[model samples]
Structures are given as structure tokens and as C-alpha cells.
Target chain A: METNMLPFMRRLQGATCTWLVQIAIRENAENLPCYAPMNIIPVKMPITTPPPDTLRCIPEFVLENVVVLITIARRTVKLNMDDADVVNLLAPALTLVLTFMGDSSRTYNPHLRARLAECLEAMLPNNEDDSSSHNNISSFYREQIFKTHPHRFQLVPCLLDVFVGIEMTGQSVQFEQKFNYRRPMYVVMDFLWGFEEHREAFTSLAREAEANMEAVHPPIFLRFVNLLMNDAIFLLDEALGNMAQIRNLQNAQESAAWTNLSAQEREQNLTNLSHTGMLARFDNILGRDTIRTLVRLTAHAPFVFCHPTLVERIASMLNYFLLHLVGPNKKNFKVKDMKEYEFDPASTVLDICRMYVELGKNERFCAAVSDDGRSYSPKLFTLAESVLVRIRGGDLISSLRDVAARVSTIAEQRQRDEEILANAPEEFLDPIMSTLMLDPVILPSSRTTVDRTTIARHLLSDQSDPFNRSPLSMDQVKSNTELKEKIDAWIAEQRGKIAHTSTSSTS
Target chain B: MAAMSPSERRLQKELMSLMKEPPPGVTVDGDQASQNLTLWTVHMEGVPGTLYEGEKFVLQFKFTNKYPFDSPEVTFIGNNIPVHPHVYSNGHICLSILTDDWSPALSVQSVCLSIVSMLKTTAGQFVLC
Candidate 1:
């Protein structure tokens, strides 16, 4: 059953559309659904006896064709071809790349494949009207490649493996370029920059891959994510008094939001508070989105989006943070030693604490805490909670305590307001309601009665001041003493009046 | 004595604040009041019942022009360097923050607290000296 492979190869060399039609039709049978956004690939094409010795040299053939395509693409000005034409032209070659990715048993030289990348980067549509090519390629991936490898999920991880040399920890894996593979993803990302359509494919794929990984090994995946989260947590912890620290990175908010914090005004940021603060504050900036994506993927214990895996992930993260709280680690966690990770453990504990409290009643986390078989400590939740109450540990106790106290006060105040509304004249009721009545001791801002913890959490995620619509800064918030005194007096007065009324009613 | 740089000023401020509200079991050496802002002497009493309990250790904090920018040179001296694996007999401490993990955000107060915490956590009997 020998068919002529040379003539089709020649046509591909000449950049004729007829060769594309032939490959799309004939190759589409075996590599069915491996074409454009049309056919969906079900499972990785089975290695049905290597594509003959002639087809084994396809990468070299593709390289030669790319060199010619480069010259032709550069020469043809009025070559009004859309993304479909380009995808069809390169569909057969891309099949070889996908096939290579699928079968790890085959010999792969990442640097050699870099020539293929150069071709795709070259073919990235330069004009605005034809900008849909990146999306088209992404769709082609989402439809077909998705079916072939459901667990492999996103192109990002594979892209990272190719470009960053990260997921290269497997047996029988040899490397020609054992150094840096960060360029491939960045080059592709750079090409797809500014287009949300292209980015979405990555985002969803990343979500799927993370979900699958977490579902398989919740503890390992979280440990990896927690370690990676170290940088963003450190940045957040340092951003205590000055929101300017992190806001400047995301380039978020107006310049007025940046309070020109002088050296004298060295306000303590989240790190100054607790390592836990820094970790939780990760909800802010690019790190926040990434963490949210990761969290979104993992199933938190017991519910929709609350899969026990997420609980396990957080629990495992808490365990490592606890070990590293006071001192340097003896060895590396993965390839690098623990000594390489610079973080404050007690503070990291607090960050994990905040994360747990925010998650609230994660049954799996609670269950893991009592189970000794879990990594780190089975007494995880209990030990961490004890740390929160410890003053010397940092602001975890005080900050969380402040939030609890403030919440109770708000509850008390709301009850009194209802009584006032029920009994008082309509005119006075308007005035009473008109006045903002909250203890500024726990809530520093006058624009609204929001508790400090709420504001702190919000600031951790974003820089905007919710009450004033200004760039919210941690340092600018000061305790309003006068307001606190008045709110206290008002609550006292309302309580006394209620007492007197109850006595009179009984008499 | 060189005119105070910004680091010196900040260190001086930190020293005053630390003296006002030193962490539990830590006391600033009275003699440091008369010295230049560049050097500080602090006394830390070990916590009760732990390995370091009942021990009295003196710590010397020496700062450079890069004081806050660089971590201060901190070590135990004058009788009691800690008898722990991480602490050397020569009075030098093996903690990373005093060297590699130092941040400008960290003050003398926080550093003292951390040192005290490290001492309280000493469980191993591998005393070097």
C-alpha cells in the first residue's frame, strides 16, 4: 500500500493550495479531526506503525518548506489570503508537531523544532483585519487536540514544557537544549498579545489542565502552586502601609492613588503584619488572577467549586508554610533547596489562615486537620488557629480579632437602628439614618461603615477605595477617634432607652 | 563620628522605638544610650522551661551606612552566644534574615523579636560551643 509521498511534498514546497486540499482530505482520514476548527480530535492518533521512513523526515521537510514559504510570503504583497488558507497550508506540518508532542518515545530536539516556531511566528498575521488567525489556531487546538488528550488540557503547560523546561522531570528524556525554554510561550504569547480570543483558549486550557492535575494529586499540585506563590506573597506582605508598592506593578489606579510615602512614613505592609497576610493578599495583581485560576480549577471539599482537593491543596500549603515559619529549610522542595525560598513562616501561617477563614467551613480541611496521615500536621487547623491568637506571631490575631469585634458591633447597631425606626418620629428617623454610625476604631474610613478587615481584604485584591472611589491605600486609613466616641455613646444611649422602655411596659 | 545618613536616622528611630516597646524577654542594654547610633547592645532572657530558658544572652547589633538597606550584623557576645546548632561558638548567628533575608521593612524591633522567637524554638541539643 505504498502511495507517492514525494509529489505532495513537492507541492508543499511550491506553496500550492492543491497540496493543502490533498493533505486536508487524505491526512484528515488518519489525522481526522486534526485539521482546522472544524473536526474535533477524539484521542491521540495511535502510533500505527511510524509514518513510514519517508514521513519520518517530515520536520526537515517542513523546515525546507518554511524557508521557501518565508521567501514567498515576504514577496507576495497582494496575496490576500485569510487565516483559513494559512492554517490549511500548514495543517499537515502541524500534525507532525502534535504527533511529536503525543509520543514521548520518539526522538525530539526542542531546538530543531524552534525553526518550526520561527515559521509560525513569521506567519502571524500582521494586519488588523486578518487578526483572527491566532484565534483560529487556538480554536483548532481546542476542538481537536482537546479530544486527543483530555488530561493534557492547555497548550500553556505543554508550551511551558517546551519553552521553559519546567515539566521535564521524566525518565528517558534527553535534551539538546537543556538550558532555557521560556522563549516559545513568550514568542507565541507575544504574537497573540492584545487579543483576548487567543488568550481565552490558553485560559480555559490552563483551567482544564490545573483541574485534572489537582484531581489526580491535590497535595502535590498545591505544594507546587504554594511554592510558586512565594514571590507574590512576599510582594504583598511588603505592601502593608503603602498600597503604592503593588499598585505600581499592575499599573492600576490614578496617580493620586499613590500616596508619596516618605521614608519617615514607612508604614508596615502585609508582611509587616503576618506572613499569612502576604499570602492572602495575593488576591491582588496578576498573581491574584493566577491563583484564582488555580483555585477555580481544584475541586474544593464537599461542594461545587468546593472540592476537597482544594481543601487538601490549602492544607498541604499550610503545612509547608508552618515548617518554614521561623527558619531556613535544610533542602530544596523540588529541584531547588528550601534554602532558596525566602519567606516568613508565621506570617505565611496567617496568610493561610486568612485563606481558610475566607473559605469558611471547608469540611475537608477540617477533616484533614484531625487526620495524622495528612502531610505536615493532622492538627493543622488547630495549630494555625492557635498561631492566630498569638500576639508575638504578628497581626493575625489582632487583625482577625478586630474583624470579629467589628462584625458583632455592626450586628448590635443594626438591631438598635431597627428599634429607632420602629418607635421614633419619621423626621428624626431620617436624620438618624442620614448620619453614618459606625465605630471608626475598627473601621477607619468615614465614607462608609465597612469594617477594616473587609477593606484590608479588598485592598489585597485591588487598590481602589470602595467608599470614595479613590485609589485605596492602607496607610491613609487612620482611626477616627471622634467618630468612634460618638458611635459608642449612641449605642449606649439606645441600649439604655430600650432598658427603660421595657421596664415601663412591664410596670 | 560621621554625620548621620538616612539609614542612620532610620536606625536611630528604630532603636528609640524598640527601647520604648521591646519584645517580651528582650531588654536594651542601658550603656547603648550613650553610644553612637551605629551600634546597639540588647539583652534577651531565655523563655522558661524551653532549652534556652533561664539563660541570659547579650546581642550586639552593628549597622553600616547601608543599615536598613543591608541587614545589621547581629550576634551574641559577652558571655552567652546560644548553644544551638544554628548559632556558632564565635557569637555569629546562622539565621538567613540577618544576612540573606534582610529587608528594609524589618526594624531592629522586629529583628530582636525574630531572634527571641528563634531561641524559644531551639529544640535540638547540638550546641556548637
Candidate 2:
């Protein structure tokens, strides 16, 4: 008879847990005693809200009871994780309380949001001992929370909002109060850092969901891609905006216009310069976090970068940034050399370029980047060459530099197309692709001339002769040396035409 | 627009020449192709006395940035896919120039001419059901 009661007992246990959780969340609930030492809690309430009459206050008793419930749920899940019955019983109650806390962050009770963040931090797995088991608990909760939400991955975005809220407050008189949420954000980041398995699982699920239906915004995975990409771009823009101001001020001081300004105006300009310097410091710290997240995303969740819109945005941003860095009249931010700026402009530039390199390693990503007419390959190759020049070591760099050099050579050959097309004879053109061929080669079987690069790309997917259907290989094709010489001479003659036109126009 | 890619430069030149002097019975939708060099829609008609005479057709060409070197994916599109043994109802064209026999020597004009000739030769071998 006792063995038969086991299933009933499990249901009874779940009902009781649900009742307790509801009681804890009630408006005027009574305080519960701390289960473990207060120190074990990951975050502390550093400041208190004003008197209850002034603002809507969450009853202190309810806050305490909720924290106790959170601690209990976290510990139970961590210890008896292997027991399916135990985990199932606790997950609902915990998810209910966690969802309430998450929703509270956006509510009118502002101070309670901070208090709830402490509870959230406490519930996260952060014990120094048995770190792996703690991580498993967090992972289990991620899946559980996602299962509850209509859109998944709400956890990271929620924590990110809280984190952004804290960062927005900036430095204030109550420094500890303002910074208390950082621990929760850091723990969430750690969870995501070890989130490879979950990432792949959720990513595929999101992709399938997307294929089945259309939504206003992209799937959560792509939203994260947009979020991170936009964050990096926005931060870089802020830094650049400050530098541009600095440039203006420096220019003003150098020019004769400086003497014409009022003393107050000059002083105001100086003050603005100093203020921007301070903001640049803040940007550096913020940028470090953004870069870390980006690096992790590119490392673990690269498929996210495969989205066409996101890839285009990244390519354009990279193009803008690289051009800014290397273009004539480059602005050098003093922050680049300072030890304080962990992610200075120079490092940010390098990281962005390296991110491109990292993502470009995958063939699918390369195909997307190279598919559109607004292709960024030449700019990227130029950047790769510059990066190679700067890093100047490593086997990978040597190999990449070789590829970059080859592309650069092709780019050089194509750069004169407008000039050559104006006067080059028809016979000088390749039998294929019509453009003046750079390295003309004669196909053995077809007895026709084409650019070597053109044929090489063609042979990647097919081996037969384009004209005769003969089995043709790269070795069978020979350089059309006579045609190449004539084409090179035509190219030189076009350059002379350009020079003459420029001189005549200037005169 | 920063500097055009090599393919875009080639496409620019092609677009210019086509607009200047399109082949008989073939006209490019220049405005659409100019907006995006990667995808083009061309308006083609069967030559005057061929089997497809007086019939209008639309051909869609999708070029990768690797154009010229990589042949564009071409197919008959819109409501008027030419009824040919090689043309599928779904706008997929089974032509050798599109796949195996593609060479970089080909241009947009050359492709249009080839498709026109293919339509000219079709005489009731297969029809779209």
C-alpha cells in the first residue's frame, strides 16, 4: 500500500510547494527566517528606499520571504539535480517567483527592483566550491525559464536591461547602491560563457520557428546579433564623436579665429574638451565588456553572424571603421595610449578587424559577405594586409597575407578597367568575362583565351572545357604571354591618357 | 557607394552598353538592375518569326560578387516563362551555360542572346503541365 502511494506523494509535494510560493509573494506576507548564513547570498541590499508613504514600497516582509524562497529553491535544485521529481516540483515555483522578480525590474517600485536583483543574484549559481554543479543548476534554469516564456532567452536580455539601467545611472552619491546589480550581470555573463550546448540547441529551435512563421522582429538569436552589433557600433560612434570635438578644438586653437572668440566661449570650449576626456574613460570600460561579449559570441555562436542583414551591418561598420583608421586625415585619440582605457580605439579597431577575420574563417560567412554587389572583400583584404603589417608574425598571418596579396594584385589589375575600356582593342579582351584580362591563359582543348583567375574560379565547381566539353585541368592551360604583353602595354597607354587629361585640365 | 567591386564595375559597363544599344527584341530593366547589381530582371521577346514570336518573357539574373568568374544564376521568371523543353514551370532553366559549360567570357548580353536562341529553337518538344 505504501509503494502505491509514491505517485500521490509526489503530486502532494508539488501542491505544497506551489502554495508556499504563492504565500511568499502575497502583498502583506510575514517575514521568514534566513535558511543559511546571510553571507551566502550573492548580493546585498546596500541602500534602503525612502519612507513607504513617499513611494510604493514592496512590503519588507514579502521581500524577505521571497529571498528565503529563492535561496531554498536554488539549493534544492543544486543538490538533488539528478532527481527528476525534485527538479520538476521546484522548477514551477521557482520560475513563478523568478518571473515576478524579472517583471518587477520594469515596475513602479524602483528600489524593489534592486532588492529583487539581489534575490536574482542569490538564486544564480555562484558558490566557489563545486562550480561545475552550480553551472548545471543555472543551465537547467535557463531551459526551464525559456520553456515558460513565449520568446526564449528572455533571461539574458532581462539581465542586460538591468545592467544597462545601472550603467545609465552612472556615478552617483550612493555608489554601492548603483553598482549592486553588476554582480548579477557578471554571473549571467559567466552562464552564457559556458552556454555552448544550450546555444546550439536554442539556435536551431529558433531557426525552425522562424522558418515556420514570420515575425516583426527576427528570432531571439538574430535579435541578440543585432543588439551586440549595434552596441559595438554605438560605442565606437560615441568615442569618435568625442575625438571629432577634440579635433575641432585643436583646430580652433591653431587658427587665427581663436583670438576673435569671447573669453567665456574659449573657456567653455576648454571645459567641453575636459568633459569629453572623462566620457572617453567611461566608454573604455564599457567597450571592454562589449568586446568580451562580442569575442565570446563570435567564438561560440558564430552561426548568429550568418544572418544577411547582420552581416551587411557588420561589413559596413568595419568598412567605416577601417577607412576612418587608415584614411588620410586620421584622428588619433589620446585614449589609445592611456593605460586606463582597457578597450581604447586602437584595440577596438584591432578587435573589430580580428572579429571579421574570425568570422570570415567559415565558408558560409564568406559566401554571405561576398555575395552582394556592395561586396567588402577588397576593403577587407586591404584591412587584412594592414593588420598583417601591424601584427607582423604568426603562421596564420603569413597565410592570410598571401591571400590578401593575391586579391590586392587582382584589385590592381581591375582598377584600370574604366581607363582600358575606353581605348583597348576588342582582341585584347578575354574571350570570357569581356574585361581586359590580367593574366590571359589559353585553354588547351578549346583553343580560346580567358583570364587565369576566371578559369580557376570556374574549375572549382566544374572541370570540363566551357566551349568543347573536353576534360581540362589547370596544368593544361598555358599563359597567353603575347596577349598579356599587349594588354599590359595598352594599360600603360591608358595611364598616360589619364595623366595627360589631368595635366591639361589643371592647366 | 564606395568604390565599386570588380564585378560591379563590369556590370556597370555592361549596363551602360545594354542601355545604349540593346540587341533586337531584348531590353534590360535598367532601373531595377542599377538599384542592385547582383540581381537583374531583363525583358526579352521571341525574335519576329521564331516559334516564340510576339511573345513577351521576363528573365531574372542573380549575380554573385564573384560574377564573370562565377556565372549568374539565370532563369525565366514572372508569369511568362517561355515554354521550352529546357524551361521548367518553376522558372528553373536547364541550360549548360548556366551550370557546367559556364565561362567567365560570358556577359549579360551574351546570356540574353543565348536564351533568345534557345527559345527560337524550341518546337513543341515539352510543355509545362
Q: Which candidate should be chosen as best, given TM-score against the real structure?
A: 2
Interface RMSD of each: 24.2, 4.7
Q: CA shift at A187, candidate 1, in angstroms?
A: 13
Best by DockQ: 2
Q: Scoring each candidate complex against the real one, what DockQ results?
A: 0.02, 0.16
Which segments of model 2 are wrong by more than 4 Å? A1-98, A101-187, A194-217, A247-266, A334-337, A340-343, A362-364, A367-380, A387-396, A399-507, B1-129
Question: lDDT values of the candidates?
Answer: 0.46, 0.59
Q: Which window of 10 residues has the lowest lDDT sum in candidate 1 chain A?
A: A330-339
Error of 1 at A365 (Å): 3.0
lDDT of 2 at A186: 52
lDDT of 1 by residue, A333-366 (tens): 1111112223233344555545544443444454
